[model samples]
Target chain A: MTIITILDLLGTFVFAISGSLVARNREFDIFGALVVAFATALGGGTIRDLLIGVAPVGWMLDAKYLVAVIAGVGVAAFFSTILLKLRKTLFLFDTIGIGIFTLIGIQKALAQGLSPGVALMMGIVSAVFGGVVRDILCNEVPLIFRKEIYATACLAGGTIYLVGIHLGVNNTVAMVACMLLIIGIRLISVMKKIALPKI
Target chain B: MTIITILDLLGTFVFAISGSLVARNREFDIFGALVVAFATALGGGTIRDLLIGVAPVGWMLDAKYLVAVIAGVGVAAFFSTILLKLRKTLFLFDTIGIGIFTLIGIQKALAQGLSPGVALMMGIVSAVFGGVVRDILCNEVPLIFRKEIYATACLAGGTIYLVGIHLGVNNTVAMVACMLLIIGIRLISVMKKIALPKI
Candidate 1:
């Protein structure tokens, strides 16, 4: 597999794991956890595809991705009990997943020739929409609104990526820079307990 | 308002009311109910707009629609006790709202130059996605999946709309025909306790 494809797959797996972990934390059953995991892993891309008038969403088109998510769900189900013992590690993985997804989303939208604003929005959607949906399905307020920093980090990553592209940076380097930017911002945001103004 | 605008407003109002009533049924607090009501009222159109790549979303572009939904939520909040007593009438109103939304979705998709298959999917989404979302937020399996022939009836209406459009029927006549088709099919489906096969 190409480097980009491998990275994409890695991102998907991490995202799926994050989703499954969240469901597990919520005490959902095995099937329910898998459903939430799959949705959280794929919901953003599905929405993006639908919005862009694309058919046969990415996961639908690529069976391997679907398999990866299913496998992720299975692994999570098996390890859920042990994994619950490592909350900090799971939080790290979830943040890393967000970082990876933001970059991938921006790249995909740019590949489609969308404007930077739209691409940024797509990135935020890709990184956070699934979580919002997962929360909604779990009958809770979305973390993006309540948690604050999650989507803001995506916006920051997308902005950095856009700037890197404008400066003619190499694709791989640009992606790395933006991913780190998201990770750093999210880490800092959480550590400092930063929050947006409540209306 | 223009004829088209008035029709759209009526559809939005009824849709919002259906959403509010469902929120009430779920015993959501006022804030939660408003969120549910707003989502139920406009979720379908927002999704339709996003899928068809319509900019800004229709409700976002027109503040009146937002105001109407807020008004509907207010009405529901103020008369929660009285409105809760009229459960059967609320069901009928919900059915009517679904019919109106199905027509609007199909028409808008056709206007956007989509094919019949896509338009039909859009119509089903418009008619049923909101309720799916509501159920998810309320922590229940969607009615379309379990309880009745909700989406199937919308599909039938979409088919009628497609046939009428292909046959060069007048717009109003075709609309009335499709609307009646949806309402009749839904009522019958509910009476007969029909449902789609679960996968």
Candidate 2:
């Protein structure tokens, strides 16, 4: 598989696990947990695809993503304590996942002939919408809608991608740089407890 | 506009009003109320169209829906007391809105060559998903996912549409029958306090 595809799958898996964790924490049933996992893994991309007019969505065309999400539910169900212990590690993975997904979203939107501005919005949407949906499902105001720097990090990464491309950077180099930028922004924000001003 | 188109717009308006009311109750700002209203007005059809591969979505193609949603937000913002007094009237409008939107969803799915079962699912999704998204955004478990008979009513209406078609019923007649079925089911369920058995 291409590096992008691998990253995409990994991102989906981690997001699904995060979703299932929230669901389990809320005392949702197994079915509810699975539904949450699926939504978290695929909801952002599904929304993106629908906005860009791509039909059947990405997961519907590829069974591997489904497998990854189901595996996430299984892991969350059977390894809750272990997963809890790995909170730091999981947070790292989640940061990288959002970074990669943001770049992928930008590329997909560009490939679909969207303007740069729209592509940037799509990238941000792809990175944060899953978590938003997950929080909403768990009956919490979405963190992104609060003071979190999450969506802003994605926005920063997408802007970097656009600028890099505009400066004639190679596509692969631009993508990697954008991902790193996103990961760095997210990590720094969390470490410093920085947040956007509340509305 | 055709009767279906008019009904679709009316559905959008009522759904928007419902969404805005929820946001107003939650004490969201006017912008937040408008966002919620738009989501409740167009979210369901947007999902259906995206799943069925129709690009640009219905609201994007018609400005009337946007206007209706804006009007809904205005009504909620400027007349909170009056809106509270009209709760029963609003409920009736919401029921009829779901009924019309359900048939519209089914028709759109069938036009796109989806199977009857899928069409039925699309119908239900169209009727209820906006409210689902609205409730989720407001940090509540979607009523349809709770004990409410909302989605089941849509399913029943869709089934009636399918059976009517199979039995060689006229297209217009079948559409009207399905709409009434949905409205009746929803109204009766509310009046009788009927609910699906909770898991």
Candidate 3:
């Protein structure tokens, strides 16, 4: 697998785990936990593919992605007994996953020939749409629009990636720079308790 | 206005009312009611448009739709005191709304030059997605995938519409006939407790 594929899997696994953890926190049944994990794993990619007229959806084309999500869920379920004791660690993993996913989303959208602006939006969407769906399914307020400068960090990272590309930087370097940008911004925001102003 | 437009508006109104009623049942505040109402009114259309690559989602482009949803919530909130007594009546309205929405969605998708099979799927999606979203927000099992023949009726209607169109039937007649088909099926299913086989 290419580096991109590996990173994508990493992001998907983290997202699935975060979703499963949340379901556990909510005291949902096993079925509910699995549903949340699957939705959180595939929701954003499905939306992206559907919007771009890609048929069959991404997860449906590959069993590996599904296996990865299921593995993530299994890990979460097995470790829930201890993970619940490390809520902060769980949050860190979720944050890192968002950063990775956002970068991958932007790259894929660019590969599809979308404009930088659109690709940037797609990246943020790819990173956060799963969580949005998860929160909605869990009947809680969506975190992206509410907290952690989540979407904004993705947006900033997307901008940096585009700028790097325009400057003729190597793709790997551009990607790493943007990924770090998202992670750094997200971490700072959390530590500083920064938030977007509600209109 | 055309019969289709009138039926679409009727569907939007009833669906929005149903959403507001559910929010009230959950004792959600006014903002929550508005959110639910808006989701019920526009959720299906938004999904359809996004999937078809239509930009500037329907409600964003048309202020009237938002106004209409707000009006729906107002009506529901006003009569909420007596809405419980009218549950059966409201259920009928909601069913009819789904029926109308299904036909419109199929027609719109076909007009966009998608395949008949995809159009049929879109119809079912349009009819049921709003309810699924509403249920998710309310933290309940989605009625579409759980109880009733909600999406199946839409599928039946879509098939009929597709066959009629393929046979060169007039579009208006085909649409009306298919809508009635959906309405009749939904009414019967609700009365008879018809359900799809559980997974």
Q: State interface RMSD in Å for all models.
A: 7.3, 4.2, 7.0
Q: If scored against the real structure, what TM-score would every candidate get?
A: 0.58, 0.61, 0.60
Q: Model 1, A44: alpha-carbon shift in Å?
A: 1.8
How do the residues A1-199 of candidate 2 rate in per-residue lDDT, one tens digit apiece?
9988888888888898998887766666554566578778888887888788678666655668877898888888888889889999888888888988888788889999999999999998888888777777777778778766898898988898899999999988888888888888888998899999876
Candidate that scores best on TM-score: 2
* Residue lDDT tens for model 1, B106-196: 8889889999899889988887887777776666777667777888888888788789878999978887888788889888987887777
Alpha-carbon shift of residue B70 in model 2 (angstroms): 20
The alpha-carbon deviation from the true structure for residue A195 of candidate 2, after best TM-score superposition, in angstroms, is 2.0
Better of 1 and 3 by TM-score: 3
What docking class should model 2 receive? Answer: incorrect
Q: What does DockQ come to for candidate 1?
A: 0.09
Error of 3 at B3 (Å): 1.5
Clashes of each: 0, 0, 0
Model 1 in CAPRI terms: which quality? incorrect
Write candidate 3's Cα lDDT for A98-199 as tens digits.
Answer: 777777777778788888888888888888899888887877778777677888988888898889989999978888888788888888998999999988
Please tell me which model should have the higher lDDT, number 1 or number 3: 3
- Which structure among the candidates has the greatest lDDT? 2
Q: How would you encode candidate 2's per-residue C-alpha lDDT over B1-199 as one tens digit per residue? A: 9987787777788788888888878999988999889889888888788887877788887889899999888887788799889889888888888988889888888887776776876887788788777877776876564556788788888899999998999988898888888889888888899876432
**Candidate 3 local accuracy as lDDT?**
0.77
Higher TM-score: candidate 2 or 3?
Answer: 2
For model 3, state the Cα shift of residue A93 in Å: 22
